[model samples]
Target: MSNVYIVEDDPVIAGAVADHLATWQMQSRCAKDFEHILEEVEEYQPDIILLDIKLPYYNGFYWCMEIRKTSKVPIIFISSADDNMNIVMAMNIGADDFISKPFDLQVLTAKIQAVLRRSYGTALSIHKLECGKVELNLDTTTASVDGSQMELTKNEFLILKTLMEHAGSVVSRETIMERLWGNDEFVDDNTLTVNMTRIRRKMEAAGVKDFIVTKRGLGYIVGE
Candidate 1:
């Protein structure tokens, strides 16, 4: 199931989006902590985001800029600010689409499905990964927790992908090294450590606590 992250602060609208998506068997997460919107995005790492322009603290444009620095995942702006300037600004900042507030769920769902099919379905694959309630962005190599986005390096993305793919299994260091070695000109051991550390830091910031745990001589495990 594809996860949709809703950044709207209004409880009613957020609930409506979640309910609408659920009918299609599509899962969605609403941002509960407005104070840390990006953090929520990082945890829920939805396949796409339904962002509101007017928000607490910094507005949607600010968050959109922050998200652009990390992932190419689609972002659709939602707000009462329906003027052309807002729409133009949204598009200029890399927003995939814009929908004014009080939208019809059916229409919104159509748009969501269309965007998802265009952005991902055509790729000939589907994947789902999460750290607690947070979703991992397989396409952009990032994670969204509590509406916050966390950027992952190429190697860090790989390590997280490896561990996420085999959640409970202890991925051996040698196995990890082999995977890294096959990439480009072969990433060294030190490079792997750096990537792991970076990924762990990103994970920690998402409120994941201990995301990757060392298994002594064996290797690493994602789920404890």
Candidate 2:
């Protein structure tokens, strides 16, 4: 679940794009306060951004320049201002890709996916996995629940990644061990238990309770 920050001002277009992105398992946040776009970008920490050129107070060029000052998050301009000058200017100021208005939703999604693959590297296109309020940043190996983030050990991240990838169902302990060590034959079963305990403790410390649930004979389930 890669988070997208859409900086379009048109309510209809923003809503349409947000809804469409949701179908691809991408989360999107539309900008509300145009005057403080950079602040919102920092707070959201989106994997990519969809920026529009003509805005209320300041235009997309100004916002793109401001974002370039601090972060390297990918920004794609989606605007009706699709003239050659606008496109060249957008690229010059660090826009990853530009899509004109009256575009196909599917094409827009494909472009976003391509930009993400390019920006984060092919291996990291799926930068985040989310379950309810819990979000795991695969690139950072950190988990955040309700905005409180915690550093995860390599084993902890692998375990959580496996479980959250199958969020609604139980993942068997044997399967989790296999994922962790690449083979269940040599790894100690108890190691998984210890890791689970630590994960739970970390979750509690971060204000999440029973985020991973034991199904007795079944393994464990998150967001169930």
Candidate 3:
């Protein structure tokens, strides 16, 4: 059973989410010390995290950043602050996905399951793949170019993996979207764009140049 750590301030919502997760055969632990959620997260070492934006002390963004410093555990933000800016900010800060407030429990469950499947499931047959001089470590969800390694969030890793697996061929936007979110119906198109931009930025920072080529009106290619 996958363990989920919920850092929601609202007791009612946290309780509801925990209960729903229980029905899905998942174990969850709620954060009681909002001021020191990082400690709780460390102690729990959950497979995934459900973070809320509005909290008692520092807020979810701060915790997300702190957690990203050492861990690549998938985080999904549940917040009423679901504006485009907030969503984009969350993604930029390393969140795997964002679900707005007043959401259906079933939808939330599905999202959680999808994220877990991607993060933990053995979808890739090989442990690593290479694009030019850059190497993607599937087991670690990180890439190294010229010996400089960069970590990737779940979305970034998935996008890069798809492109590398089909190296030299443009993987269409729709195909990538389907591979990332299981379908395009539930996710915004721009989210994929944001993930792609971040992945390219990370690659560039790690000494990789022009690693992903964008073919206008088609998709992206890793090589050739």
Candidate 4:
């Protein structure tokens, strides 16, 4: 599943846009904390970001720049600020596409699917896993959210990717350690703990909350 992050402020519009993505069987999230847009971006790590021009604290352009600094993910601007100057500004800041207000939902969905297909190689991929607004580009060993990218340490990426690929299912620590062996690393219990903690901090700094759930003695799981 492809994860999408929405940065629009209007509740009604945001809900509608998210609903549209869901209908297509694509997973999506509306930004919950505007001041921490980057955090939200990291937490979700969406394949694409639907950003509105007018936002709280700072405009979409500022957030776009912040995201651009770390990722090459796709960003699509969606706002009533459809003026030429704003559109140009959005594009110049690194947005992949622009969808003006009063547009058709079907049209918007089509555009989203197209962007996803192009960026992700296909619209729907089974081997891959998704969480928050982030997509683990399985084929590339990279992670993207709202058009931004994160340089994940191999161990860090592997653990989280494993959990997400099996969202709602627990993955044992022993299994995780075994997987790490493929990279010539023998991870002890504490080693896995350190890695998990670091990964969690990174995700938290990116604005995600309670994304990975610990299953007591069982291991970890990406909660649904």
Candidate 5:
């Protein structure tokens, strides 16, 4: 499922947005610890973020810029500050879209869907997977960890995507090779091993430790 993070501090508005998003089969979490919003976002690794202006610690613009340093995930600003200047500033600060408060839920949902499609291609059904602090963008074929992003080769991206999709499950090497070969890549055992090693090195260099764990004869997994 697509994950969305709601950074609105208002409990009522946040809860309402979360509920409406749930109806659309999107998983959402409202921010509770505003003090460490960025850390929470890194952990959540949302596909999209619904941010609000005039927040407690820092405004949406600040957080949006902060998130931009680490990720290119789509962010849509939702707030009562509907002035042209505010909207312009939000866009300038890396916001994908903006919506004024008291807006129709259907309209908001449609906007969210559009942004998701625009940012991550037309496949709104595919989810961006996260393992610990690392987030793999399936659409972009890229991986981000601790604010640093690395472009993954097609094979490498597929391998990480498969493992992150199965998270704790032991994805057999045969299963991964099948996926790569199905993409017309013609991957052999050695090629798969090479790709996995490269992925691990890139991830570790980006400050992701122990991201992919080898299960000896089994396969590989993101977590224990």
Candidate 6:
């Protein structure tokens, strides 16, 4: 799972965003210690950061510059200052994206997704996951086994990716559904079943056998 750090000091906004991100299976943490922003970044090692412009002590631009000195992780500016100059300055200072204050949660999530996709690779952020002879390339969104390869649909790729992330652990069905649908709230159980079945068929076709295992009442697991 990708980790996102929220540098906004506003408790309400930070809490709401973190809660919404959780539904998408993305981990997030709000910045509590403004005095040690860089230290927090170092310890968290977040994949991405959401920064606010007007902050206590140092501003977002300063923190962004400091972060850029050591890491290439994506930084997105979120603030009430929506002037063209501030936006331009943010981009010039190394922010990957910028969101104006009072933005929709969906818009913020979309921007986050776009930034991550550009900073990292495609669908799956990490490069590849391997189990025995089978390999999944996150950038290409394809699974390969024994020199044979097969492309996976979006849902199939996510399902396999989730399983591989947990590996030996049994990922619950509810968790998988939340990752797949986010807050859609209307997904049926049969949809996930169909996706899992298709993933298994694709793996088999690509020369991979028994790659994903089902656990009676639990969800799925990749590695032994």
Q: Give the count of colliding residue pairs in each prediction.
A: 24, 0, 0, 14, 1, 0
- Summarize candidate 2's per-residue lDDT along 1-224 as a digit string, tens digits: 78999998889999988976764567999998999999999999999999999999999999999999999999999999899999999999999999999899868888888888888786546578899888997655689988888998878988998899999999999888876665448777889999999999999988889999999998999988
Residues 85-136, candidate 4, lDDT per residue (tens digit)? 9989989989989999978976887787677767777545433457768677
Clashing residue pairs, backbone N/CA/C < 3 A, model 5: 70-147
Candidate 1 lDDT, 1-224, residue by residue in tens: 78889888898889978975664456888887877877777777788999999888889999999888888878999888999999999999999899887788767877776788788875523444775656776545567777688886656766776777678889998777665454355555677777888877877877877878989989999866
Question: Lowest lDDT 10-mer window, candidate 5?
Answer: 179-188
RMSD of candidate 3 to true structure, Å: 13.9
Candidate 4 ranges with C-alpha deviation above 4 Å? 123-224
TM-score of each model, paired residue for residue: 0.54, 0.57, 0.55, 0.55, 0.56, 0.63
The model with the greatest lDDT is: 2
Candidate models: Cα lDDT each: 0.78, 0.89, 0.86, 0.79, 0.85, 0.85
**Which of candidates 2 and 3 is the stronger one according to lDDT?**
2
Cα lDDT of model 6 by residue, 1-224, tens digit: 77999999899999989987764557999999997899999999998999999988999999999999999999999999999999999999899999999999767877887788898776545467777887777646677887688888868877877788788889999888887887777888899999999888887777677888988898778787
lDDT of 5 at 62: 89
lDDT of 5 by residue, 1-224 (tens): 78999999889999878876764557999998997889999999999999999899888888999999999999999999999999999999899999999889768888888898888786674547787888876545578887688998867877887788788899999888876674455555698888999998998788777888989999998866
Against the true structure, candidate 1 reaches a TM-score of 0.54
Which is better, 1 or 2, measured by lDDT? 2
Per-residue lDDT tens digits of candidate 3, residues 197-220?
998888778777888989999999
| Candidate 2 local lDDT, residue 224 | 88
Model 6 residue 49 lDDT score = 98
Worst 10 residues of 6 by lDDT: 120-129
Candidate number achieving the greatest TM-score relative to the actual structure: 6
